[model samples]
Target: MIVSDLWRYPVKSLRGEPLREAEVRPWGISGDRRWMVVDPSGEKLWAGEHHDMVTVSAARTGQGLRLRAGGRPDLHVDEPVDGPPVEVRLRGVGHAVSAGDPADAWLSEALGRRVRLVWLADPARRPMSEAHGGRPGDVLSFADAAPLLLATLPSLRQLDDWIAQNGGGAPLEMSRFRPNLVIDGDLPPFAEDTWNEVQAGEVRFRFAEHCDRCAVTTLDPATGRSGKEPIRTLARHRRWDGQVWFGIRVVPLNEGTITVGDPVRAEGTRSSR
Candidate 1:
């Protein structure tokens, strides 16, 4: 198998940036999920709940962060190095630094609500939740679960075939799942369910858990339009344990650069490492 695509989400919920290569670290890709949106009350906002968030695209420019949305002028935000600290509720009590009022105002104006941009300056400050299969020393970014999510083209093809046989609709896009790494190879669909470790390029990662699909997957990342194809289709065939599964979450065991076209191999059994 080989890596087909790589992506990083510098800000949670906002659209992600596709890359040809990236530095894989313990927390994930180097710039992934370093920032997130929160309300004045300190509750983290999610695109799954506030669909408008997906409309705003965020990218890391050579200088700083750039945000763009339909009809709105593009805005550039500098990283707040000495910015004021703020307490944000992200699954657990977490700490972050405010991105200041200008960035906050721009984001709020775009999302059409009162919101603030908070950067998780130190991802290690928050412990990974044990309930989500976190192990010791497992640092987490603003990513929903583990550090990375992997999806295979073969598996998506299988799901697409199933959807076609069911009702003959359009094929679902892989963007629906927002996978960090997309792999393609001569393997059976759902073969990753048996993997405990994977080696991609020079990096090695241990499996964390199967990623569950939610309403967020029903929304198109480009237009923020919600649909019922993938989610509805996943429920029919991939449903189990009260959740519909798609990708697999993993945490890096070693840091290294991973690039598109790099070879990928499943290295361990489900019980190993």
Candidate 2:
């Protein structure tokens, strides 16, 4: 198999930037999900709760990050250099520094709510849940659990076929899943389901868990509209443990670069378990 695409969501819940190559660190592709939008209470706002969160796109610049939304002026924000810290509410105890007023105002207006922008300059502040296969020193950015999620084109093709068979409308866009890496080539559908570890290019990864499908995947990325989809169809075939699953979450094992077209090798192709 080979890596077909790579992505990094600089800001959680927003549109991501595609990369031809990425610096892979333990925390994931450098700069991914290091920033996020929060409520006035400092709680991270999610696309599931606020669909508009995905409508506002963010990109990185030399200075910091940039935000753009339809009918709104672009907002350029600089990294918070020792800025006032905020108690970012998370599933676990976590902390982040505020991105200041301009970002807060821009996001608030765009998402139709009062929210603030915060950056996790140091990802080590939030530990991945031990229940999610996190080991000692395992850290995450604003990512829900693991550092990266991987999907395969073969699996997607199978899913689209299932969706059609089940009368679930057109083939879904891969963007809906927001996977960090997309692998393509000769492989059985859902081959990743058995991967305990994989080496893509120079970077190695440890499997964390199967990523459960969520309402976020049901949102139409381009239109900012919500619908029943891949999730609904996933339930018909991939459901287990009371959840529909799709991609697999992975944590990087070593620091290196992962690029598009890099050959991928799954350690022991099938799980020894």
Best by TM-score: 2
RMSD after Cα superposition, model 1: 2.0
State the RMSD for candidate 2: 1.5
Q: Rate the local accuracy (lDDT) of all candidates.
A: 0.87, 0.89
lDDT, residue 54, candidate 1: 82
Instruction: Residues 1-273, candidate 2: write the lDDT tens digits.
Output: 999999989999999988999988878888899898888888888899888778888888875999999999999999997889998888654678899998898888888889999988888667888898899988888898899999999999999999888877888889899999999999989989999899998999999988888999999998779998978888889998899998899999999999999999986455521
Q: Write the per-residue lDDT of candidate 1 for residues 199-270, one digit (tens) a residue.
A: 999999888898888888889777888888787878888898898999899889999999999999996576
What is the lDDT for 139 in model 1?
A: 81
TM-score of 1: 0.96
| Backbone clash tally (model 2) | 0
- Runs in model 1 deviating more than 4 A are 271-273
